[model samples]
Target: MGGGGMGGGMGGGGMGGGGPPPDGLRLQYKAANTTADDIQIKPHFKIVNDTQDNVPLSDLTIRYWFTRDGGANFIYNCDFAPFNCIYTAGTFGAATGVKADMYVEISFMPDAGVLVTGDTTGEIQARLHTQNFTLVNQTSDYSFDPTKVDFEEWTKVTLYSKGVLVWGNEP
Candidate 1:
């Protein structure tokens, strides 16, 4: 499991800090996986509507990025949309378990007649939006220890677009 980093910081004297601040929060994708087997990507988003005010999540869009070679690095977008994909949803206040669902589908094929030489590896990235998903309470147990237990953070949907490779040939 490869680990990534978050880019932004919390606002000073904000809700993340303490006191009367707006109820807007954002968490970005901060991890990648590059193992021998096929890559699986999952995105987790948290929305906390603690105030009496009702929050509306309309027109939300989530984007995910994937990469084959690890380097200073070229990036490719996963060919899946949030509306068509399935994702995880949970209700917990500051420490709850999150269920996983299929949020996207990925497929790859060698360009006509071209052949893949050796074992190939890739990376995946996921992003969440506030517009489509809204949180009514603080999310608990959002993070889990991969070694200790099996948690369904996301599900992968299969799309049969083309023939698969079998015994070094298209089946």
Candidate 2:
């Protein structure tokens, strides 16, 4: 009675995990403030749909990896987002990797809307700071880039589509 054929996996149901979805996506970065020793780590992002087909925003998630500096109650904020920041939520958790013991995971509500071809979810200004407003060093942060004063394609940050790495190289 135990054939063990069908499987539950990454994308779900009977399909096994291969990799992220075929839809090509790029994560753009622009640092609102590049001071690594400052009170906040600002990593501005924009998700570019580089494919021919429209992608649902509900299926996408962006992760900014960093350390909490041994501080608890870290705060995350979306200063601005064109896709309605209200539809976006940020959570922090421990992760397995170098340069980061914790990460800020950005997720969207079901009504986050679809991303059309060659379109972008513009200027998602994400901010992270300690609860006491103390300075947190971002110099070694996996996804923090001080050189990106202007928007450019940044691969340090990771993107997931339906729980798979769709873009960027995780540190």
For model 2, give the RMSD to the true fold.
6.7
> Once superposed on the true structure, which residue ranges of model 1 sit more than 4 Å away at CA?
1-22, 26-38, 59-171
**Candidate 1 per-residue C-alpha lDDT over 40-128 given as tens digits, one digit per residue, 9 for 90 to 100:** 32333222223333212211122222222112222223333232222221111111122222122222221111111221121223332
Find the candidate with the highest lDDT and give its number: 2
Query: What are the clashing pairs of model 2?
Result: none
Q: What is the C-alpha RMSD of each candidate to the true structure, in Å?
A: 20.9, 6.7
lDDT of 1 at 109: 20
Question: lDDT for model 2, on a 0 to 1 scale?
Answer: 0.78
Q: What's the lDDT for all of these models?
A: 0.22, 0.78
Candidate closest to the true structure, highest TM-score: 2
State TM-scores per candidate. Answer: 0.22, 0.86
Question: What is candidate 2's TM-score against the reference?
Answer: 0.86
